[model samples]
Target chain A: MKNILIYLRLGLRNLLLYPMRTGLTVIGLGIGIAALTFLSAMNDGWLQNMKLNFVLTQMGHVQIHAQGFEQSRRISDYMGDTTLVDEALQSMQSMQGGIQAWSHRIRVSGLASAAGANASVLVSGIEPEREKDVSRLHTFMQQGTWLQPGDKRGVVLGDVLADRLSVGLGDKVVLMAASPDGDIASEVFRVRGLIHSGVMDVDNLLALIPLKMAQHWLHLGAGVTDVVIRTNSFAVVDSVVSNLQQRLSGKPLEILRWQEIDPMAEQWTMFAEIYTWVVLLVVIIVVLAEVLNTMLMSMHDRVREFGLMAALGTTQQQLFAMVVYETLVLVFIGGILGFLLGGAVSLYYGEYGLDLSQYATAFSFMYMSSVVYPELTFNGCARILVAAMLGAVLAGLYPAWKASRLNPAQAMREI
Target chain B: MSDHVLLEAGGLCKYYHSGGSDVAALDQVDFQLEKGAFTVLSGRSGSGKTTLLNMVGLLDTPDMGSLHIAGENVLALSLSERANFRLQRIGFVFQAYNLIRVLSARENIAYVLQLRGMKKTERLAIADHWLFEVGLDGLGNRRPDQLSGGQQQRVAVARALASKPALVLADEPTANLDSVHGESLMSLMRDLNDRCGMTFLIASHDPVAMAAAQQCVYMQDGRIVSVATP
Candidate 1:
């Protein structure tokens, strides 16, 4: 440790003497690290947004179903006694990260016809009061009103779905689908609200109606097709699913987490994370080059000094260790400055959010909101820091080896 | 196990690959120095004086030579062993006064002791003793560039002898100094030699340094021409 400190002192003194070169090298490395941190924060924020608005709101954390419903997804495969199942799920809250909300849903593929136009859509039968607790459907209502318990024939239509069908709130529409017992069913419903969730799929093909009304229309007889659940955190989804499966065993129920229910959501999260790592990988590579160049430049400049040390009883290995020390000092300092600059930018945007309203049209962006808040997590920051530190050490190796390889006599002959 | 000689070098041969042909830097040179003798290898430019210093310092290996320093045959030692030999047993002062410019005079002298795995307090104390011995007492805190040529040379000498090596090789120790500093630098080395019985083999073209030496080895065309006791 003492020798390391001395090597660091020597490195610091050398860098101080060549301030401009060291400053420029540091700035180069700093820019690379800052770019990585900023991009990582952006990726993390996007992932959070998806989990919050898309996954939790639409898929929920876990979805419990009748045994065959996961395969067929048919209205006929409805589960009975949803409240009993929900109560049972709540018993083991330790593994669930605590369930936030759960809503019984009866979803069916149907056709909507209104104003002499027709379009295919998924009709959701939900208890308005309970749905509001679990999903963003109520909040996304852009027109009219959410369903109230007493309104038997009331319905909510996605704005784009309604547009395609040439219908609006207050307009009457006909919904047709297959009944549970294999009968053709049709119902006349008055649209109560127009919802535009800003998600292409949700906006183009979804409609909501009262649970009792759907139960009557589909002849479900006090049964729900699925029970969508929300938890406090998505990280415990796997454990929650396992616990729910174990608890709901022997009841002909197939409990599924959001990752299994909506595989694309899981895939998208991984994709976002991988994309950020690839970008950081490139940035780290460039930073490594900068560090290596700085070390090599210093070695070239100090041949005589190195030789002098060699002749003065300092071994080649000690000189190589000095190179390592020099590189670590340079990289750590640059990494710190980089994180500060990058963190400042990320934190500012994280607070105020980055309004991508202008770029929204140009960029085919994902998630529901145009504004994005970048996230800076300790885990994420630590990963980048570790990568930067390792890259710096790797960069130092070649230059250090070259320094140690120098001939003391020949090097001493240099100016 | 050998005689009382501090350095025994025989059949030394060195060649440099120049533009085309190899030029002999040392031609079968045989040299020996007894313990505590102050000697100089005096030669003009290209006379291989620096080459001989580098060879004796173990900074370079001769194409053919058998070297024994402090009774150990080091010519057959590996590269790392040669480095260890330099570290533990030999000290060198460059013609350019190659004091590490970044380190203070105290640090420069102490660094040699540091390499020998000496304790910090002991190393600095020994450094201070050498500093005062070589007439650089209070000026130990100054960096090489901050000191004059003479002072830098004094610090270099202090650094070399700090290890108390079996032999010290100084290449043109007075080549960069004027008459006054040159005489002072040579006189300081002589004084250190006389007081501590330290062995010194200095390579120089400067008459001041040559005059201060008790024995002079003259080199011409990579071979020793004469040995003078003055």
Candidate 2:
């Protein structure tokens, strides 16, 4: 250990002998690591925005439905008794802090006609007072007001659906759908609000109505098709789902997390994670190339010095260790510089957010917000640092080997 | 191999390829140095004085030779073992005053002791004593580039003797200095040799170095032609 410290000291002194070369090499490596850190923050921010938009605007963290309701979507597949589900939810809510909110709804396909124009739509029967607590759908309202409990004939239509029906707030539209009793039921409802969610499917084919009115019109008698649940955080969704499944066991019900409802969002998250790693790999290679080039150049410049050390009783292993120690010092400083540089920039942007309004259309297509807040997580920063050091070691190996293998006499003879 | 003989080499031969043909650098050289003796090997350039020193220093391997230093068959050691042997038993001073430019005068001298696993304070104390012995007492903190050529050479001498090796090999130790510094350096080496009872074999054609030696060996075309008491 003492000898190793001496070698380290020697290596440090040798590096200090060439300040300009050492400083430039450190800065070059710093810039590469900074790029990696910044890219990772951006990717993290993008994925967060995508998940938030998908979960908040429509799918809650978890959902429960009749066994075959998701695949069939038939009104007859509704859960006739929500007694066990309500009991499970009440117990969970009493436990304090996992389930944030929940709401029951009846969802069915329908056709809307107004001003002699018709369009296909999926209508949701919701309790307005409970719906707001479970989803952020009301927050996306573009016009008029959300449905109220006493407003029996009031309905809300997505902007695209309203445009197709040639109707606006206060206009009456006829909604027609087949009841589970084998009857074609129809009703006239006044449009209460217009929702402008960026999701094309949601904007083109959704209508919201009062739960009591839909229950009466469809002759379902107080039954709900599905229950949507919101957890305090996405991380707790799986555990919450498991708890609910256990409580509602043997009751012909299926429990699912948000990812199962919108598979594309889950796949996009996976792709984003994989993309970050690929970018990290590429950046590490760049760092490796830069460090390798600098170390090789430094070694060539100090060939005679290395020869002198070898002649002064330094073993081949010691010489190799000296070179590695030099690289460790260099890369360690660079890694800190990069972490600070990247962290400062990310923190600044995280507070104010990076405005990507010019690419709003592209972002909207992916269900992402126009302004993204760059987040630098601890894990992300640690990953970048570990990878940079690993790259530095790999970069140092060849030059260290070459230096240790030098023939002392021949090297000392170099002018 | 008498007990007083510190180094012995027989039938030492070294060859180099020049113009696609082998040229003899050291041809059938036979040499011996007694403990505590100061010797000089003198020759013109390319007469293989430095080549012989390199062989003795273990910096180069002779094509054919049997060498023993302090009764150990040095030629039979492995690469790593040879390195350890050099560390513990041999010291070298080069013509270029090859002091590590980054280290202080004291550090250069203490580096060998450090490699031998000596504690910092102990090695540094020995370094200071050697510096004082070589007339560089207060200049221990100065780097080689910060010191004059003569001062740097003094520091190199201090470094070589600080290890108290079994044999000290110097190749052209005074070639880079003028007559004044050269004479002073030779006087210092002779004084150190007499005071410490250390064996030294210096390769130099300098008249001052030749004059200061207790015995001189003259070489021609890689062969020792004469051995004389100066």
Tell me the tens digit of each residue's lDDT in model 1 across B1-230.
Answer: 34768888898999999999999999989998989999999988888888888888888889998878888888878777888788888878888847888899999999878877789999999999999998888998998889999889888899888988888889888888999999999999999899888899999989898899999999988999899999
Among these predictions, the greatest DockQ belongs to 1
User: Candidate 1: what's its TM-score on chain B?
Assistant: 0.96
The deviation in Å at residue A368 for candidate 2 is: 1.5
Clashing pairs for model 1 are none
TM-score for chain B considered on its own, for each of the candidates: 0.96, 0.98
Model 2 misplaced regions, further than 4 Å: A1-4, A68-77, A108-120, A174-188, A216-220
Chain A TM-score, prediction 1: 0.94
Proportion of native contacts in model 1?
0.63
Candidate with maximal lDDT: 2
Native-referenced DockQ of model 2: 0.67
Model 1 lDDT per residue over A150-243, tens place? 9999999888899999887789999999988988899999999998777766778888889999998999888999898887787777777776
Interface RMSD of each: 1.3, 1.2
Task: List the candidates' TM-scores in order.
Answer: 0.95, 0.93
